[model samples]
Target: MREAYLASGLTLSDLSVQVPLAKSKLSELLRGIGLYPRWEIVSRLAALLRLPHVPLYRLWRQAAFEAHKSREWVERSTDNTTALTTSPAAPPLDHRAFCELVEADYLLYAQTFLIDDTACHNAVGDTFDILWLTWNEALASPDTRSYAWTMLRRTIMSRTPHIDGRPHFTHAAFDTAALTHLTDEQARADHLTETIALFQVMGWLPPTQLDVTVLRILWRMPTERVSELMGVPPALVRSSQHHAEHFLKSALYPTDNEGRTP
Candidate 1:
């Protein structure tokens, strides 16, 4: 469709006169970045492109069938895991059920590491689109779940902007700034508060370290998996994680002037 549209020298906007579809919407279908389109829209697009409708419809059906099979594979693969591997593609389902089953997991994870609601949604949205388009590949290999998971991580790392690490808050700084209370209850509250604050502050870290820490350290993904996602060596993934851990420890749990827990 894309090739035909280009070859015809008619922009999607120009073709919109002949078909009742939005140019951008057509692009989504042509790119396969979105869910299935209505038959009328598909037929219109094929006709406008001077392509035979039946063959194009058959192609759509084949992709949809593969997408459905992959959805079943994902559901089965996810049923056995603690954290849902973030693959966005699934066969169309009841809207409420879709959110409960698929969208919630990624949203929760995104909220945990991102700075705000916009960042959270934006962080997960691109991955969602990519997965929605290509997640069927998950069913092809023996390491089905792992392959799906690696794709998810790579999606995140690829889309997010990099942050260069500079000196930032460490745990020791916070400890000195706030005197520890005498009671155990106060101590626990302070601990919980600081731990959460530390997580939010991750948004300010180098994006690479943030990716490394979230994938390699917090998620406990294998170094090789993180490496593949970040497009770096496994050793560097480990090293980035190591440095990220050290930075967080210093920022979230500062020691006293005497080198003791305050």
Candidate 2:
């Protein structure tokens, strides 16, 4: 809302003329320090700004209901009957809880992409950027956790989807399998070196293969979860990951006719 106001380049005085509010009151409203406007006022303002009404109506309901009533609840069952009960109010989540959720998500997220500490931190930071810039207002609603999760997921998805070794992507896109098999015990001992090489090799893989490997090995996410996130079937996720592993093993550790690493 603030963003739209800013983009319109409308000052408080300018907004006052469009709606029945004073500059001071408008300032307070913008800062979240005043009473919510009546539905009529909300409707007028929404029209002036050309914003959608459904969600704005929801905001009005939350404020109006909370002020006049106690906890509000809705009930449902698998039988499709509407149940009624006074459910507890949603607890407000502070910044601490938000950070904790992000951290927990990252424990799974950090596993999906092979990123340095700085890059990973930047990715997490990016989520907060979205939170404050876009979704912060929505946090006041009952589904704060879901809002936070969605913003973070969007941030992660926005990042470079593939390992970008780019100019540094050595022509080593060729067969290095004979040089080091991913399955070799000796190669396993040099994980750091192998990991670096693997990252480069991954840069060459198609998006599907790379994404599957990331969700499975790096994120350690279950097939169903990966399927949900990627919008693919579980079988496809497994198949892609399997083929990716085969290519990686064959590419990383090729063998001579003797069936030994040359």
Candidate 3:
């Protein structure tokens, strides 16, 4: 919201007049220093910034949910759901082109993080809608692809269930055929232990290294494609992959340091 406000080149005083919100309260909203503003305020600000209200409303609802607002309260707050859902602001052509370019890879990334098919689709769809709402700010960023990818990652992480402050990998572990097909209870338990340990290690990796390892190793995409998707140079992608490999080896096999079992 702040980014879009900045990109709009509108002064607070002008926004005060336009949004009819007090300068102090508007500052709080922009800086995220106060309680979540009412949706009416957010919707008006989005309109003044030339942003569509649908996605912004969705974001507001998400924030409210995270703030522990009940589903009933959220539903009751919506006076006209049909109008918000059917808002007529179409995405720009460039935005559509960008979506076409990266849609497949976005789905793959979301699917890997969220094992549920329905959740994956919703994640990607919400991401695109968000990108649409903030397209101008995204274009102003250093790398739009990187900006969008970061948004996608955050969306998936927010939806992913966690255990003990870490992402729960039990569902992801079952995807491995070797672990899933084990009929013997003892063998199945052993494979699950190993698989979950690997996933835990992967989860602990820095974001860049984790993404590089997933795209390059798990998805088997070429280096050039990974570079394009990540909005980083090919050299950086290769370097991240190398670092991820070393980190995984060290993390998963600390007992065998320097190829010698301790």
TM-scores for the candidates: 0.41, 0.40, 0.78
Q: Write the per-residue lDDT of candidate 1 for residues 1-262, one digit (tens) a residue.
A: 6766776788878877866677888788788778666556665666666554433444454445546746554344335423212322243243224334435445544543344567556545544444333334444555433454455556445444444533232332233223444357777667657655765567566766876776665556678755654457778877888888877877766784349976
Any runs in candidate 2 off by more than 4 Å, and if so which?
1-107, 110-189, 256-260
Would you give me the overall lDDT of model 3? 0.81
Candidate 2 residue lDDT tens string, 1-262: 5565766667888778867788898778667677755565555555656454544544455446546633332111112322222322222246546665456555455434423566557656655544543444656655655566566555555554533543122233222344445677666556646666786776566767876776686557789876755556789988999999988887777774348866
In candidate 2, position 24 carries an lDDT of 90
lDDT of 3 by residue, 38-123 (tens): 67677677777767776677778877887998888777667533332334567788999999999998888776679788788878
Best-matching candidate per TM-score = 3
TM-score of structure candidate 2: 0.40
Candidate 2 residue pairs in backbone clash = 111-218, 111-219, 112-218, 177-252, 177-253, 177-254, 178-254, 180-252, 181-253
Which regions of candidate 3 deviate over 4 angstroms?
Answer: 9-13, 18-21, 75-88, 115-119, 140-142, 158-171, 181-184
| Top lDDT model | 3
Stretches of model 1 off by over 4 angstroms after superposition: 1-9, 21-129, 132-188, 228-231, 253-262
Better of 1 and 2 by lDDT: 2
Ranked by TM-score, the better of candidates 1 and 3 is 3
Cα lDDT computed for each candidate against the true fold? 0.55, 0.57, 0.81
**Global lDDT of model 1:** 0.55
